[model samples]
Target chain A: MDTNPLDNASPGHGPVVALFVTCLADLLRPSVAFNSIKLLEQTGCRVVVPLQQTCCGQPAYNSGDYESIIPLAKQLIAALEPADYVVIPSGSCAGMICHHYPQLLDGDWRDRALQVAAKTFEITSFLSDILPIKRGHRAAIKLPSVTYHDSCAGLRELGIKEQPRQLLQELCDTELSELPQTEVCCGFGGTFCAKMPEISAKMVHDKVHSAQTTGATILAGGDLGCLLNIAGRARREGVDLEVRHITELLCGDLDGPAIGEGE
Target chain B: MEQHSDTFLENASKALGNKAQADIRDLLGLFTPLLRNAAVDNFEHFEALRHHVKRVRQHSLDNLDHYLATYEQQALKNGNRVHFANSGDDLNSIVLDICQQHNAQRIAKGKSMITEETGLNDFLQRANLDVMETDLGEYIIQQAGETPSHIVGPALHKSADEVRQLFLQKHDLGERELDNTEDIVGEARQILREHFLKAQVGIIGANALVAEDGYSMLVTNEGNGDLCANLPPVLIICTSVERILPRAEDATAMLRLLVRSATGQSQTCYTSFYSGPRREQDVDGPLETHIVLLDNRRTEILASDYREMLQCIRCGACLNHCPIYNSVGGHAYGSVYMGPMGSVLTPLLSSLEESNALPNACTSCGRCAEVCPAEIPLPDLLRDLRHQETVEKITAPRWRIGLKLHTWLARNPRLYHWLTGVGIHLLHLAGRKRGSFRKLPLAGGWTSQRDFPTPQGKTFMQQYRAQRKQS
Candidate 1:
């Protein structure tokens, strides 16, 4: 049973895509959004960046402020309603839209939320599942070997384990040294990082250590929050690792410094 | 024993600082899951069995009243007395009253988390009753006068060297260099063997109580439970009300999940079913048997939104897979129940106000739900507890206020972008040199541990708008 509605999506006709540029990607790393736009465009999609889009309300949702997330969910639904497909750069935010929106809203808003959720896809999943990039004999782009972090929400909530890996292996020429315990969270769990910093620190340190053990100079993941946490810790610990979003490498946006690196 | 769940962060900090224990926790976090995975993989029908057992548990919980009545009737017919304790105090008093009724001087106990929850050992000890733990792990923690850290392995936090020291100091049996693991076991066995024989009553916990037959099922690697049930003249099985199953097959079916999930084994060394007291043909068993079913707010949980938690088989798979539990270990949870299940169950068992920190301690990795044989949505349950905290204003006012401010800003996208754009651009300019900040005001929690990466120039929304205008 092909349960996924987006499984048969065709990109040759240039479907309209509304990019839900997550708050972290919007503020912490704008290039993730730009690169995501480029990737979507390359797949014959007319990508639209909705200006009305803000945060996905995961901070409020995760912190147990269900009252606050309702309005945010409605606003996001309204803002991104017109698109044929709503795309996101990060998995956690996409998870919020896909998994949690209906959980947080009610009645007609829930129906709208569900409609939007069905159309929403994380960038890698969007590429691989809906509008897969046509393969060619193009040479692999020059980059250091990388390891991938499976962001928790995407991997667990949406079953996004192989989509990104498959896409990265197909698109990026760099060797992907699979991270040990890649399924474990890097501990940038929204407000959890701020509230439980000591535990989060230990968790991120473990994740960074695991990535280091892979001996991959570059650590890449589909989500910006995890990359930022890993990159921040690696920099603080004086470990020479270039942390990047998969889109950055796939789109050849190497002009900017790696996460937590100087211009 | 004590509810320090409110101080979870502090305890976690202390646990992390204790490098030796934290390393053990890290190893446990790594290895326990691997072991469980191997067991699950070895079983061809693990997934099917997991679902089957989950349905059986849900059915049992759903028809709890009917099953409880049936179990009680069957148990009474089998010559066993059934007692329902409304609270921890009720259960402790009931057990004490039973011990006093027999004029029991020495009591041998098997590993019973229900007893732990009710603080039965401390209660009985306070009454000046000679109570001894029979399970090796329980005996170790009992000797140390400390609560069980891990439910399955109570003294898991203790090093073998510490156990040797404990045995040397506590065991009066003239020990000559108890160096090897076998010698230590033999010495403990030699001492516990006396207590087993002399004890007037044996107290153990049931893994499941079958309604169809009056038999209470228990599984253990140590066989101490069977010894505790049979050796003493009187036996008491202390377990939660949720442990009831419709039939013996249901009990065995659950065992298939529980054993694999707990120790990653096909079966424990011992799986015993106590029908009642000693029968006419039975050579050795307790003369009188009693089953104490502790309610302890479980009925309320069964009625509430968190009823799915009742399906938990106490496998500790959640604890093995939890990142938070991995980082801080079970003791840091500061509850009788620890790890993901503990976090969800502790608050429901106690007041959420006192244990709000337990729910908030989670990173919501959802691994617990993934590995749970009962299929409990542990992360969602934890999140709901946090929701209750918010609704009741149990969380700090500042945290609520911060959430409110962010929510309000998020609802208005333009203002959100404008405010965030200015802040991010300023941060980009400030930390553009270093590419991150070592220290920042109001971000002490984050900066204290790791650097905060600087934003990449203008916010994406701002850049997107600018690009749109240019085009």
Candidate 2:
């Protein structure tokens, strides 16, 4: 059952997308990429995975190494050229490519960056916006209580806090407790975690503690970096829980992942 | 202790490391959910109120000079003397001069960050005037001889035991044990009561100065602001220029957002409007009122890239929701302003050069912006400031050079990937068996606290393209 409204790429309504498998989806989490494809393709849009796409330069840009970020940015701009829209799964990556990258390439591709930016939508937003297809859950899978952590980028930069949750509500008949500090950062701020270890450790610990208190068996969010941070801390603390991206659960492809299973 | 705009960031950061900041951050994280839930459930009119507050702030910013003048005129018409300060030094002098002219010896102050900005207490203490903070939190920190950590809850960092000890040390009590929150409040109230009644000048911060009313709307949970503004013979208001609103009703929209967003209170227990000096037959109010509009780099901020920073209502929601502030906390930023707003304002009020650490303290998370009733684009503003820091060449030299090198390679992905892949391969080889490294030389911070996982056999991009080709 193709739940995606983007299953058919009608130029009249379907968007030609520059697929941005954000830095995390590109480096750390690959299935989020495959899951992203199934989700986007199901929606009826033409997804183009530009091979020239590299890091959106968020790591460098955030580290105040803007100069180092510019060229990577220019390369990405050139790779996704002529796409009517650019779709990304991760909010942090989407935020970087859509929000910060354009500012870096202000002189040459400023207009192009701005143009691509306007059309760039997160996969969940694309599902909610361009797709809006009725969600078809893969067989009824019962789960214990869970809550959604609104990634800062997805919530603030993209206003994607609700769309994923709205979509997730249909996936299973599970207890959903809105995360207490859902809007607060789980502290995976690219290099910030490295720059300030004590602070980062304490913050991740607190986030895990708060999530645990909700009595939810599963914690989910959009960005993998934050999920990894929370999941790592949850495992380190030996809390009984599973952490997964909203997409993996939305696709019902999530399996065999205990906290810190891969790491 | 003259305030230095330059030392804002370094001071803030160091202060945040005082160990107390962590405790405060933990506490703040706990209390924050309360406000966020209230904001979301306003199911009644949260969005409308958010829009209303945003519109009010926008209106105030555009017609600022006009509103300030209107507030001044209204205040003067109500027999309040209005003086403007272009800098902290000017504000301090105006306050001191007012105190001196009025023969003020002992003063009582409510919680006023602007007074802290002016270093007014230190200034008054230097001149041999006995100054006391009447707010319970302010009084606690005053006794502890520390600056206020959180804006709304100044003594929020201090635990009950610490306060018990501070109160015991400050007062000659044989066995008056501060058992709970109510006891602490009672003790502080009793101590500050005389000061409030007998002080020559009672100073307070105005939440919103209504331009049409010639009055100041001062909000406080304890009603201390009213006492501070009304008790003494000469009452003075030390506030920044942006506190002025178009009318009393305009503030209703903001007040609707402010209290609800601040402490989750539908309305604070006490909301008082003080027009001016007491009328002839008034039972008990100040004989004279003074309005000190403290600019102190605000005009420059208005002229600079940070004009929107003026829209802050000082509700401290940003501090509560800020992850950086939650982790490092406010004191680490070292500037008087801490949290998200401090990261932006500290540089402006202080110096961009000295406060370079402040702007970089953010994760560019939108939590602060989302929770902010004022709807200030805090993350965007922080990024813009960082950009300004880069363009202005105020950032550390190493960062600039590193950025230069990164830009050079990143322009060519093949080269960038080759270099990173080689580096990645070396790291993977170095930590293969363990699947993660507890410590890596280059990223010592990651190693210091936790492990960094080796990028498995292939990066996601590598697998992504291969999978795409197969399809």
Candidate 3:
């Protein structure tokens, strides 16, 4: 087999990135990871996935187990430390690393935490804010209509409301529909979904209803936790809709079934 | 008032099912935000004013003891008796002693959450003194023998029909048509006017206690608080120690945000400051003035990570914006201070075990923090309380163990991938036909309300590794 031409490309002129594949994406949908890599490569970046990487420790941190997250935080810091920039697809995980890590870790470890935090960027924001890919670059695939759900952590913690939408509008032929109270939580607050499921269900039910009212066939969001929640409830309610990560549409890879669908 | 905080879920469920309560919540959901938006738009520098008010509150809280001491000294110099109580029980007894010393028979009260917190009305009634709640909302709730639900509009949970029924049942006057809300209000006004004149003592909550001068500021739209203070021979101000401000201007800074936040108005109809009893030149005022400052676990909160909560001006903005409060009105919180503020304060003041569910009931939507005029991080405080619960082993054992196991797996990537890969594969096979699970073993709580989505067959890492080899 011939050597890949992209491999021989020099790294100095392009941004070097470490892909922090969030646990939800890693376990639930592998296409999101591949699409993320495709989008990053299209931007002319050399991306690396550290083998030692696992989760962002948000599940533990948000559950009030600060002590339990320490070892996980240390592992994450070590895994992502060698890259020029760390990019995450999920805003919740990125927020955990960028906004919460410094607060979670203590003393001498805090400086390293801050260093990791300062270099971390959510993928859409990395594309829009850091190395903005201009609009009018259409993807090969087209979606009929899609509504974007702004996950609470992504919206409130990281201020990532417009980055994904701007990218979607720029890269796809899909009509973007806005959901009512889209800034409100879809109730997939990590373990919060399990701890207070009734309240969570009510919130997600309302979210699904709002998305349905927008008459969009596809529901898109950057956070898989929220997508899975809205998708799961829509399936249960017999509401015919597709829920996919925005990266899949942006990268022109809609091969697999939507979230909570076929194996 | 009886506290059903321990049964918060049951109370919330009941409130959610009540049609009338839901209607009231919908009205408030529309009204409060519209008024707040209008108020904000009318004030060109409202955001800057919010920052100024936050700074003023922060400075006051930082030197709370100094301000409280200054307020006490100034109040005493103005010929008002200042009393301090360490607990709610102490506060109730102090008020009782004051009433007994003056042989107070008829007492008029203007919406005081401090008194509600201390159960002062019940205690006074038990002691044979006749107490009347003079605020229109307060009077309706009193006639119905129900507790105040909302802080600003105490009887907000009651609809117009309920108010009509309450007045028809309680009022001794002959059959009068209470057909409209205006007529109901007029009836309450006619009844309360008599109490306002005949009351021997009047008790009111202070919006802020000025330190530069011993002035207790009161904000009311109905003009009842003013009448309650001036008509009675004795006036008693019930407030917490944290309500003290350094100067009158600081109080103004607070009111700028408070009125806009509480009722969506630039200012209440009556904003009066009473420094002491009747002055020599005054036409009409109370003969004796008293200020009762209650600690009620505030000093402890000030010394803790929740010190920022003391800066809250009790504007009820958090309540107005909270989704949970909109879902299941304020009475479900089972605390005098309801919604986001109550969730944090109830657990701190009351037993954590008893009020344990309050913090967990929140969705952490951050709307409360978004609307808080004092810039209090309510979600962070609630998280802190949850952490305390975990540390104290107050949370359910199954959840703790589950979290511990998840933490153990997350810390080890190789093992985590191995196990989660197998788990996801098995789930995919089990759920391939429907793509979701109607019932899950450990996630019954989630599956009971909504189906659990099945994972994709292979883990992303496994697929990535395989794809890299193929390429």
Candidate 4:
């Protein structure tokens, strides 16, 4: 009946954020992990990426296998004890870890879910206002025209907006193209692409069409799944566009070949 | 079940779902955060309205025998006769019988997609009934002999030129060419006015049925539903079972979300709550009113795992925001409902065998969950359906074996490591400095179009183990 919907204020003693570098960031998109580090560091609070950290068991949890997720959630909560914050990168994983984990652990797990929910914040959010950053120190990075996409978890579960764009807007000469029907999902939904490849393909196709229509030379987003799907399609059509993590553009460490160059 | 065209899925897959998933990560960029911001901004609870509406529907369905009896009594009290339809045929017969009794020569309809679903017009026309559509969009699609692409915005998929061509070909115009949206709309308005005044029966779809007061809420942008219900001697409102709500206030709250999410409007141009037939003192309303609540397996849907599907108010907001519907358009869906809601609903509303392709039509990216007024978990539900589809063995046998093998290998770390190591090495050897594969075995559907980037050489487990030992 009563789960406080929003985290309107920071704790009196700034909450200690325990970083859960979701399996994707820990393994593939380590740069997301690193940039997340920079964002947490900007907060000027104790930020620790726990060594025992692993997957949020979302894949198994979403697949409707509760048994697998329970142990992992227990281990996660135990590994980061006395923690006031449990910040994570991926929206889907963070949402599952925060909302679903407690359900898996019925009795005491509800309290833990409350505990985790109280502290967990997506990277851009923590930096945007919580641990206030310098008013505006965006470095200039010359680049082709670009647009932004919001991930599902961050959009629906985490309520994240403006933080990434606030950061992106600060970077100089970044001509961000406005997406028509920008809030529509690209359909990379974790196991969804693999499960319903055909339907997933159509959604990505539509996303590419929107991007191409905007004449934005780049597609930028915080989440990897959306970018991966869109980039894959662009790679197929050989569209003259680059896809980069918002962090990579912010950090200005892009080393990959120009989109469609490899082809 | 009629099999899907399969091309839509194919084209979409080429765009979003493929082996390129692991390598790229920007697709989730815009939609995810836009919704997050919207929710944060839109958090004051309209829970009372939701509860009211839900109960209204339940109340009407429970005392359906009583409500039907009372609705009949009320309409009759207002000098209107009531007709009940147990099935589509029965409804068609009842309508036919009334039109025959009244000798209704011209029938003017105002955007009743429910009629299209029930094949009502077809039945009437087959019996030589003269039916005329009055709404600009409905009139255009009627002329073209095509079904509506969207519930609220019929003929949304059509460009002005296409509509112009249809009107020019069908409408009696000496030499004038129809140009612009206003011109087409004006042309239809001119054509339908005579039919509205002359038509004996006007059929409409109620946005909601209020149980508290025995009134029906019908809101329209052009005031077509009003004209259809008011000017005619007989008015027929055909609505699904779930449209009933407890109170008019709840309808107003639902209207707030409905109009805003659908078209960003505070309210429709014409919002009216009609109770029973017209009074003698009333300026104008139908002499006789009919409210037909069609079951059509809706009762079955309510009892199933898909009860939430009934929560849809048919605002077409999901379609308005759906990526799949935005391209190739709605005719491609081959069903009345299209987009996220359509993908879930078509199967439930119709034969699953034929409409099975609808559920599989989602990318499950979860954007549909963001803009939903009723807050339906569309992406998650779609994923659940996919799991059910696999369980039902509706998927091909080869897929079953493949998924089983993948799940098996994933469960076993030893085999998973060995297999992935070999797979990554082969991928590296194949692509090497090339950085991508134009083609790969088993999943050539992806590689044929795009390159699959070779792995970073060391697996995450290997990197993690080495780093751990060093620490």
Candidate 5:
């Protein structure tokens, strides 16, 4: 690994980015949050985690309980409202706040929701779009050849197809294997995986098969929900492949066993 | 024809379990997107044309009453009789009456999804009239006593071997083996020619109806639509009222997207427009002509929040791109329409109780919306239907309660973190050895299919706070 002195200091004064560790990353995989912060801070930014932040109300929004999503939206807006920028590690959650929050919250809260949404960004896009991280300065980490799965929300809703791939190509010293139908979903639609498991299984099964066809030993994605779903299915079906968040490999923090692989 | 949409889960389960059908599903998954993408790339102005067609359809729908009246007047001037049917049963009875008045038998039919929606073939057969499906895909499914599985390619789910077996059982051809696709096509053509020549009345579906000249447009690859429309003494056109356009130019705008999106062709082999019966100057045409416009709950769809769905041109691009439709095939929808469009339209046209599971089948991937030529936001519409399901209390009470509890907890950040943190810590300890659970309470839907991975020891929020303090 090439250690180029990863520092959290900006060139002169970096923007204050409140790290919005999504509910999935908060509960299931904390490393994604750490890696995201590392990546953000390495590009010269002040990072803070608002303690009051919780779920993004995506579960309720997707389940058609719009009535219940209002307070959650309000909670997110109030907590992240003070930051210069709110950065998210997961695209699904980022997409919810950026695209769905303004639509879900109404009346007086709608303007605040939109304001919060404007500052929110998925981590990779935040580094690339807002901060303009120099490619040569990235820490060079060697990783196994991997195929990237574009989470549907991030890819379609937020136009996040190229930012992560660009980061992996410029930073990582490994082959970026391209999977067929990379834009197709892995069927991990939050509560969707639990509610419609059979269809979800078949979809993820096809996704894994496509990834394997690229001869990639690992699958990397932006969303923890998709990574968990794909990794869990791969493990269940005895497929010999590892899954990881792209940020974990990008931040050079690949010490733990791959997702769904260890005690 | 039959409302088995209530058994969507059972049908999907059965479709998933079949290995041979799985192979066909895989082929379709690979084939359709390639064709559609190639067709789209071939045209430089496809996006612009899509927008124009969307506006035209929207404009027509807005002024639907004026266009309908103009079409009625123009059609009457062109010597064609127009009739309206309020429901599927009414449409069937009107057609039955027309056939009875003509003493019609041996009806040659072109591919018509509206006919399938109304179950007209079975009704006519019950009335002792011979209804022969001339379209090859329709003919194959008809012989098998099955409904069309796809809108455009009715027998797409059937493999060549399946079709061969179906033919061998149904056809009385001599010991000659009919194994190849060419042989099957030849046999079907020969079989259908007899029906085409002897039929007294022909029935075909209109792709679009022009209010300007009272003309109905029919598009086909096999030229069967032409034969059905012109080779009989009386011609009857069946279509939904939503198929009307204000001008022939508007129909042209829609055709640009329809043909390419439906079959990946710049244009179909045969696109014919008919106004009325044969006049004294006409050499070859029907002596009598009639157009039967079916409502069939479409007016309700027009009046409801789902009015955007009426903009659909039945192109099947949404169906082709839908992942769930590819997995389960069209039969699982158990309705005349299938895929994303079907999930939205079936519930509105039929009862929500019968097709409740259709909307839940979506993963909200948004591919259907991405490829829609009509620019219908199908995922949004499906979500609206799901919202309707919740408001109407059609979803299971237990599921609703679970969602309610989740919402309440999510609204309270402290309670949400405390409860989930404890829950994850316990789950991590319980499945530490295996790193996964084969069985779990309240997650049988997930665990039944694959092992649910155990959460890492502490939640990210807990770790983040500790790390922040240490720093």
Candidate 6:
């Protein structure tokens, strides 16, 4: 994959974007974060990774452990506060900052949360909404027919249905075959897969089936948690489809194996 | 009736494993959303109507006391007896007293989730009254001796063949072949027709209670509600107090959203508004009319953050669209109200301790809230219930301890990073060849169902820091 010429430009060329590498991306799949940085850099934005950022506090928030997540939320808000824009590679984490932060904090903290929320955008939406790289600037990525799974938080909470598709089609010039039940959950609800594994299995089973039915070799999505879940299940089910985060495919960073696949 | 929500996980697993009912649930999952979307797409002003009705529902619930009193007074003026029951048991006894006072033996009933919630039929049966469900779906489930697996389609869990067997086993219809859908309906119709004519008392649930005029609105596809309300000598309308609205137009506006969401129809076969009993000039109608309002936990719900839940109109849109509902079906919920609405309301009506798992039995997909005509935030309410669970320490100690450890680590990022770094590196080394783990210790729940993906060699932070130094 050829690195975009613009990506080599010095930092501070445009708006400063603090990349919020979500916990799953940081721990499980760093390629998502790397590709995300490349995409943002290609858009002429100065990308900064905030090391103090640990998580968006969703696991605690979703588990009803509000008391535990509040400080983490504050820590994240403080960590990403200085950036002109906070771009998350994952929609679930982005939604957490943009939507749940205001609900989680109060008073001055609430105002700060809203301020940070106003500038936070999921990676694909950030590229499409904040900095739309026209056709001339698009990277020449040759991908197989791609199908997408809309993560629940991103689809319903943030209305991220068309952003990734538009990016894939416009940027990579790839054929995007639509997955049936694209809006349905992939059964990786943070801790839900562990808490109610049976139901989660059924949901992921249905999701993998739908993806397989699409006949697309690659199933791409905005959130890594969902990708890991679908890819993990698809691997176990002996399905041949490759699961990837949309960022990885978009940036043509395919040297590493697909999710749940070894070299 | 019995709160089995505590056993939701086990119940869901059983439902998932059962091929027969799971097939039906899978079919419902596939088609119900399509039907709802088709109806919504066809209606040009579905969103506008939904918003308007949401306002109507919110306004009604906000001034619930005022509307309830106005309705009762107006109902009394129309010669209809209005009674309020503080609890489910209270409501059951009130209905029983009304039945006994009239010496009612055989009773015909329409589909009423409220009655199902109160276990009214079982209570009345204990009193030795021959009560029969008049609605085709309710009648089938009544004969099969099963609680409703769904609010709209009570016996939907049963296959057509299952229903055929149920009819043959329960009905004394000789050796008739109930092989087809039409034949099944005809058999049910023939049986229900006899009970509708013979029953001295009839009971039904109202879709909405118009407070401005003493009228109760009911929408039914089969017109069974009309038969149950008008054919008997005495009529009883069983409904919750939250069904009240300020005006007739409000009820009709809500009806527009309700019908479309519930069954994806523009209108039901019968839309009846009962304004008390028969007039002097009326030829045929119920001689006595009684309206029973049950307040199982409406007042408490109205006063809490979950007040929005009371705005629900029982459209079953949430149930139809829920993935969790699709996975396990309604019976797994172990309550009359199942699916997303039940997940929120069941805990509020009963103690959270009794139905804690019901709330957790969700992926928080927000599809329920997306399709809810009343616009109640089902996921948010479910989350609040979980919050309540944690605050009360109703959750398991091991789970809380795990959360606390994670929280403590999260607050201290250095420790979190160090620990996560070591853990990721270990996992990467262990699963380097396989790329994933078939069985992970302490993660059996996940590994049992799906493989756990291996971490890429180094943590992003570790790699990022190293790259930054090189750059």
Off by over 4 Å in 6: A1-10, A135-139, B1-3
Any runs in candidate 5 off by more than 4 Å, and if so which?
A1-12, A135-139, B1-3, B469-471
Question: On a 0 to 100 scale, what is the lDDT of residue B209 in model 1?
Answer: 90
lDDT of 2 by residue, A1-263 (tens): 22332332324345677677765655555667777777776677666676666667776677665665666777777777667778887888888777887767766589878877888888888778766746565554466677888787777777786787667665566788876666667877877676556667767777888898888888988888787777766655666667777777767766634324553
Instruction: List the RMSD of every prediction in angstroms.
Output: 3.5, 4.9, 2.9, 7.3, 3.6, 3.1
Question: Candidate 4 at B95: error in angstroms?
Answer: 2.2
Q: State residue A104's C-alpha deviation in candidate 2, in Å.
A: 6.1
Q: What is the C-alpha lDDT of each candidate?
A: 0.88, 0.75, 0.85, 0.65, 0.86, 0.88
Reference contacts reproduced by model 6? 0.72
**What pairs collide in candidate 6?**
none
For candidate 1, what is the interface RMSD?
A: 2.4
Selected candidate, larger DockQ, 2 vs 5: 5
Angstrom error of the Cα, residue B21, model 2: value is 7.1
Residues A1-263, model 6: lDDT tens digits = 11231232236769888888988989999989888888888889888887777877787788788888888899889878888898998888988899889998899999999999999999888989889855575456888888988999999889998899888877776778888877778888877788888899999999999998888989999998899899889889988878899998888877888889976
Per-residue C-alpha lDDT of model 3 across residues A191-224, encoded as one tens digit per residue:
7777767667767877898898999988999989
Q: What ranges in model 4 sit over 4 Å off?
A: A1-87, A100-148, A165-182, A191-220, A239-242, A246-263, B1-76, B83-86, B180-183, B281-285, B395-422
DockQ-based CAPRI category assigned to the predicted complex of candidate 1: medium
Q: What DockQ, between 0 and 1, does each candidate earn?
A: 0.59, 0.35, 0.55, 0.19, 0.56, 0.63
Q: Over the stretch B67-129, how does candidate 3's per-residue lDDT look in tens digits?
A: 888888999999999999999999999999999999999999998989999999999999999
Query: Ten-residue segment with the worst summed lDDT in candidate 6 chain A?
Result: A1-10
Local error of candidate 1 at B456, Å? 0.8
